[model samples]
Target chain A: MIIGALGPEGSYSEKAVQIWILRHRLDSVGIQYFADIEDAFLAVIQKKSDLSIVPIENSIEGSVGVTLDLLHENGVEIVGEIVVKIEHCLLSKGGPEKIKVILSHPQGLAQCRHFLKKYFPEAELRSTGSTSHAARLAGEFEEMAAIASPEAAECYRLKVLLPNIQDRKQNYTRFIALRAAGKNTAEQVFEQVLCDTEEKTNRPENSSHSAFKTSIIVYLEKDRPGALYEILGAFAKNKINLTRIESRPSKKELGDYHFYIDFEGHISDAIIKETLKDIKTKTDTLKILGSYPAFKA
Target chain B: MIIGALGPEGSYSEKAVQIWILRHRLDSVGIQYFADIEDAFLAVIQKKSDLSIVPIENSIEGSVGVTLDLLHENGVEIVGEIVVKIEHCLLSKGGPEKIKVILSHPQGLAQCRHFLKKYFPEAELRSTGSTSHAARLAGEFEEMAAIASPEAAECYRLKVLLPNIQDRKQNYTRFIALRAAGKNTAEQVFEQVLCDTEEKTNRPENSSHSAFKTSIIVYLEKDRPGALYEILGAFAKNKINLTRIESRPSKKELGDYHFYIDFEGHISDAIIKETLKDIKTKTDTLKILGSYPAFKA
Candidate 1:
């Protein structure tokens, strides 16, 4: 199976996918990467890749809308999830005073906006594709500095001007693993068994399949008032507690939106099946995007 | 007052602020423009400019976290909001077949991702500072296409490959006007008049002040379970009807978040004020970000 990630081979998506491969003991010879989240999603859509890892949200930056919208428009399903800590560092080719500009992804640039404001207030901040690319550019130009990862600074041969410069101390990203429209039963069962075995080694008191969560995206009929309420009524009736729900524009019809909902139970649960049936009865479209182990479970 | 906007003169934010200035009849000489959202925010924070305008959310792209977080950290109040339609065009310095790459601001790039996927599937997509910057780059280079505004295409003398290629039919941006901590009575009175005029223009039959919404950002003390519940309980008691709520990491402390909420009432209402008091009693901090006329109202 081919694996795709967002990268020049060192983005957070790359790291998340690599960690998933290592944990799953999957082969990586046919693995590839793209520079943008949409590219990674399209790779899955076109059957160029079996699975793609893209960031859906970050603790510091909130929602990554591009990923959210692509999942809304396409037939890809989010079969699993992974959380990676975001560690941002300030890198420069020379001392801080020598830097006239700072470069990083717009998200990275925003994550460190406080540090940038407090210190390099006069530097012209710029946006690039990824943190590693920013660090690479900083290494190539004496007047440039980068807000990136420490690993990226070393890889790009740039010195760390300031370490751990993210505005928040505990920033984490929630990335979803996208696969073609159906489930891989063998992979799913194998992952569950592995998780169970791993839990046996050092199980936390809260560890169980019950703790796992599932996310699904649905689109309602046009300008339907109480439409969300009707769809949500199913979950409420089934006692399937919803953890979160957010809306993204459908893009197919003006003002129509896809509702992304997260509930506390897996899709295999009987209650979930009943709830989805009820939702389909009330909504114009219902797409089961994925059933995944939610973050920190 | 010194006003800052995004520009080298003509761009979305520049046009947005200009519309605002014309609507309010403010002076052009008092206005200064920056190359990016952060720069505009900084202009206000550093007292280089007394106020600024930045795009905070788009119908297709959702939240512009850079602007949101910058203002959140810098302690600037969103004095007002303006919704501007986003019309994107594809410009080129080469023929369609010769164009090897497409460049744009990340948001603009994401907005047109569907177009790229369907048409120029093989083109390498790159992101730059702004749409106008991409147009300028296209003017200086060969074999490149830029996803930008028609104004940008005209300004840079680039060929328009396609016009209005955005995925959403009605792509609108919600731009927030910022000022320092305190309120100016004259500006407030003027804004009230403007707000009333806006309501009169857009008021549909069966519309009320409670028809569309109210937005607020709340922060709670750390290590409190059901803190959000208690705060939300106030609204539940009044049946105020919450439309949306989003949580972003509060840079002040690790593992803490500030919840931004949209409910359905003005702060001037008695129940809303009582709700605020109840929420204040239950939470560490509560900042009413703004209670302006909700978009599309």
Candidate 2:
């Protein structure tokens, strides 16, 4: 399998993908890099990669807007999710004392600002494509160091000038793995079959039940009062608890927002599917991003 | 008045403050530098600077969460706002062709990612504290360049490797000048005048009409259904229009938010004041942040 991620070696996206790849021992998977998340999605849409890893949210930063924006515009299904605990490190080309300058992504730098100020108070802070790229650049320059992930140091062969350099110890990133539509990619690792064959046969002969959570994006028919209330009423009427609902301004029109909603239950569930059918009639557009078992953070 | 901004040069924040300073040129005003916006605010809170200038929002990036968070926490109050149009330039230590690396703030770098891919496809992209800081470091080294404001090149004594390097021409930032909560201490360059003085005098002496906007932060008495709605209804009953309302998770308690609100007029106006008093009765706590003329962005 080919996996595409935001890269030029050590971005948070790259680090996230690397950690997941390592944990899953998917070593044979071909990995490709893109300059941005949109490009990474295009790589998947154009069939350049079988699966792609994109950061969905950071504990400190909240949501990755670009990732959500692309998910809205592109057609892809979230098959799996990886929540990796992030520990940003300060890396250098040579020894810690030899480091004259530091480089990292803005968020990475922000996360480690307190550390950088305390330790490298006199050193200049620089921004690189990603923490990984910064690590690689640090390795090439005699006076440079990087603020990035430990995975970055391993990738670029740099020494860890400082460890656990981030301001927060609970730094975590949630990444989503995307595969082609209609693919049943949910792992049995976290799933428990709720059906007993004998009991199932005693009921409806072909009946089946599986616990699932659904994700959907809806564009309002127009910008008007009570539009959101009407859209939300569907889930409320069906007694389906909404886990999350966020609004992103629709690119097609100013002041119009596309709402991304996540709720318990599968799209195939009788009540959910019925509510969705009514919701489709009320909304300008409705697209299901996925219906996978919820991953507990 | 001594104004502290993120500097060592021409950065978006620096240019933003410079534009406001030169235009206002408060009598006997001076400028100082801080590592970042948070430090700039700290300068005022710690009595190190009389005033501080910091970016609160960007056209594309929405709100600067850090700035908003600072405003919510610091004892400082926003006195004024200025909108500065952003123009990004590509600079190099040697020359454009000699530029093997490009450095800038992540937001700046993200805005110009398309341009980078189109032109300097092979040049490495880097991040920094600010565009000004990037220019400062790029000037000290050769082969490395920076994407920063044109003023950055002049301030750092570096040449503009390339002009108009940003992908879009409409990048702009809205900056707010903050000072410790006290009666105007430095000078009265600008005063919070009524938006419409005619309406104030024309109304009966006891009339409740107001011509200024007031901002307030409130904490809920308890987490329960209809609490926010009941609080907001106080204004609605008085025909007061709520211009903006947002909730930020109050880190102190789980599932509780501190609501930031902006209403049509000042607390001095009887109707608005009465509405706030009524809200105060229902809310656990309410603090008026400021009452100023509504800013047009």
Candidate 3:
């Protein structure tokens, strides 16, 4: 089996796929790297990989707009969700004091902000394309340090100058494994790779845990008063729980937005269908991104 | 009079303040450049700048999360709003054939995505801290080009190789002028700088345009089903229109978010006051982020 992710081999996206592979016990998968999330997502559409893993959002960095936008644009389904805790390490060739420059991806730079300011206040900060790339650069420079995962640091053979320096230790990023809309990637994973996750399916046949989440993209016909309120009222009257809600520009006009909303329960449920039907009447468009088992934060 | 904005002299934030100053007819204002939004926001708190212009959102880039976060953290009031159209220019010392590298801020690179792919696909794209900084670098390097504002290109004396290359021509960014809360800077501006803004004020004595907008920060007591729906219901029932709604993490933990919502109507209205009273009951905490007249998009 093959999987697609963002990389030059040591990226956090690569790390996320590694974690997902390990969790599913799919140890024999090949990893293909892409330049960006859209490229990785495109790999799935192009059938280069059976599935692709890309970050949807970070707890600290907010939503990964590219991923959200790609999912909105393409006919892809989020089959699986994984939350990876982001741990930033200070890596260098020598001691921390020897570092005069700190390099990292913007998020990496932001996550370890407090630790960097207190220890490397005088160091020049540079935002690189990826933490692994920063690690590779830091490994070649004697006066440079990197803020990245220990995995990326090890890949570049750099010493860990400091471990877990993220401002808030609970910082995590949510990644979604996406595949072509019609493919049942989740069924394949549960039946062949991992049976425990099967405990999570809300297929009505699954006997174990049954927590499912449905994601929807909503577009109202007009910017009228109570337009969004009426839409929310549909879900509220039905007692559905919303996990997340965000507005993104429709890219059509200045004030137009498509609300990306996630809520509890599978789309197959009667109430969920009723909610969508009502929302359709009130909206210009409604897209069901997918329904997948909910993952713990 | 003095104004604060994010800058090193040629930044877009500086351009925003300049436009605000020009529109308000406050020609004698001194512009103080700050390292970041917090520094500029802090300037207002410290009474260093009577007003600070900071970006709130962009048409394509979405929300400026840092500015949103700082506004949430500080006791700041948004006194005025401005929308700046982003026009990206291809700048270089030599012609397009001589350029092998492209430099710009991430947003600048993203805005002109199509133009770069078509014209400079072979150029190595480097993300700089700001478009002005990119212009400065492009000016010094004969083999590099930059995507930045025309003003910044002129500042560095770089040639405009191409103009208005953004993927979308209607791209704009919204900036808000902030001051310390409880101090109606608009009232003072009307008395001293700009009287028209005062006429638009919600103050009971004001006899001009009454259209107003109110922004609020809401933190739900718990992640209960329909908590947000109930809050939205309050406004919907009152016929208030929401201009924007975005959720940012509270920085305390994952899954905890503070919803920053902007809606039409003045807080001084009895209906607006009643809506807040209802929201207060449904929320763990509520903060009024202050309001100014709605700016045309």
Candidate 4:
């Protein structure tokens, strides 16, 4: 089995994959790393990997907009989720006091802003393509340090001069594992997928997977005074709870948008099916991304 | 009078200010440049500048999350708006064939992806803090080029090797001019504010000024099944058209969020006032960012 994720080997995406591996105890898995979220997602589409892991949202920064956009652009279905606590370590070849520059991914740098200002106010801050890329560069310069994953420090042979330097300790990132959408997808083979998950966790098969959530995208046929209200009413009338709702520009006009929404309930449920039926009547386009068990439990 | 914007003198924020200046015909205003959006906004809050202009949203990129978060962090009221079309120019000292690296702000590079893939498939793409910053560096290297505003090309003394290189011709950015919130702000002195916008556009003062839009951020007391539905009900029942609605993390937890909403009608309107009253009852927190005229003619 080959699993794809965003790379240079030390990304939090890789960490999420590791967490999944431990849960499933997969021994025959090979890891493939891609340059970006889209590329990682494409690995599944292109048949290079059986599954792809993607960082979906962050507790501090917000949704990874590009990841959301790519999910919409591709025909991938999310099958599983791994929520990882994000911990950035200030790494260096020498003492922290000797470091003249700090390199990291932009988000990493933003997460450590308070720490950086309080400690290395004069150090030059630079952004790299990935945190591990920064880690690799940090190893080459004695006066440089990096904010990255501990896995990256190990891979780059750099010491963790300081640990968990993020401004917020509770910061977490949600990564979803995706596979190509089609006949063998989650809905069609729900029982088999549960069996696979059951083998990993050593849990009972009949533990009530009632917290399944469905993802969908809706586009309005025309701009009206209460177009969105009419759509949301469908869910509200059925007592369906929405977990998330975000609007992205359709790129055709300023006011027009495509709404990405996640609501509680599996698509197989009668109420959810009815709600989607009503949504379809009011929307110009409706795409059911997938139904997956919520990570909350 | 002074206007603050993010700049090395040629950013899109700077261009947004120039558009506002032309529309208002402000001749005596000095332009102040800051390293980032926070600093530019801080200039107004710290009383170093009377007002600051910020890029609030882009047609292609969606809302500027940092700008939205900063507004919530500070006591700034959006007093006016300026919408400027974004046009990227491929700037370089040498021919396109000689360019080996393309540098730009991430958004700039994304906007010109089609152009880059077509013309410079092999050129390495790099991200910068700002497009103008990339242009400044591009000017120093003959083998490097940047995608920046035409104004940036002028400031950096680089040739516009290609014009209008943005993938979308309709790409535009909406900028809002902000001032300190208080009795002296637009709300307390609504008449004077309209007079100001009216004089700048050479229009009669009494078109009712009904085109005003108000921005607010709301946080639910707790995550409830119909919490957001109840909040949207306030605007829907009142027949207020929501121009934009986005959710950002409250930084407290994963599900908790700050919903930034923009809708038609100012706070001065009777229906909008009633809506806020009812909304406040249902929400744990409500912040009235400000009311401003919509950029629509």
DockQ leader: 4
lDDT of 1 by residue, A1-297 (tens): 888887665577777887788777886446687866778878987888988888887777767787887776777767678888888988888988789888887778777767887897777666566677777778888899988887787778888877888887877877888887754432243244434531221112444545657777777765444566656667666666666566676655334567777767665554665666577678776666666665552
Clashing residue pairs found in predicted model 1? none
lDDT of each: 0.70, 0.68, 0.77, 0.79
Clashing pairs in 2: A10-A132, A126-B127, A127-B126, A127-B127, A127-B128, A128-B126, A128-B127
lDDT by residue (tens digit), candidate 2, B8-76: 667787776777777776677778888777787788888888888888655544446567667677666
Among residues 3 or more apart in sequence or in different chains, the pairs in candidate 4 whose N, CA or C atoms overlap within 3 Å are none
Overall local distance difference test of candidate 2: 0.68
TM-score of each: 0.76, 0.74, 0.89, 0.89
Each prediction's DockQ?
A: 0.23, 0.18, 0.51, 0.52
Docking class of 4: medium
Q: Which 10-residue span in candidate 3 chain A carries the lowest summed lDDT?
A: A186-195
Error of 4 at B141 (Å): 2.4
Candidate number with the higher TM-score (1 or 2): 1
Model 4, range A168-286, lDDT digits (tens) per residue?
88888888889898664433433333344312222224434346777888888545767888888898999888888888877776766789888887765657767887887899887
Winner of 2 and 4 under DockQ = 4
Interface C-alpha root-mean-square deviation, candidates in order: 4.9, 5.1, 2.0, 2.0
Model 3 ranges with Cα > 4 A deviation:
A94-101, A113-126, A183-204, A207-210, B97-101, B113-127, B182-210
Give the docking tier of candidate 3.
Answer: medium
Of the pair 3 and 4, which is ahead by lDDT? 4
Q: Which sequence of candidate numbers ranks them by lDDT, best first?
A: 4, 3, 1, 2
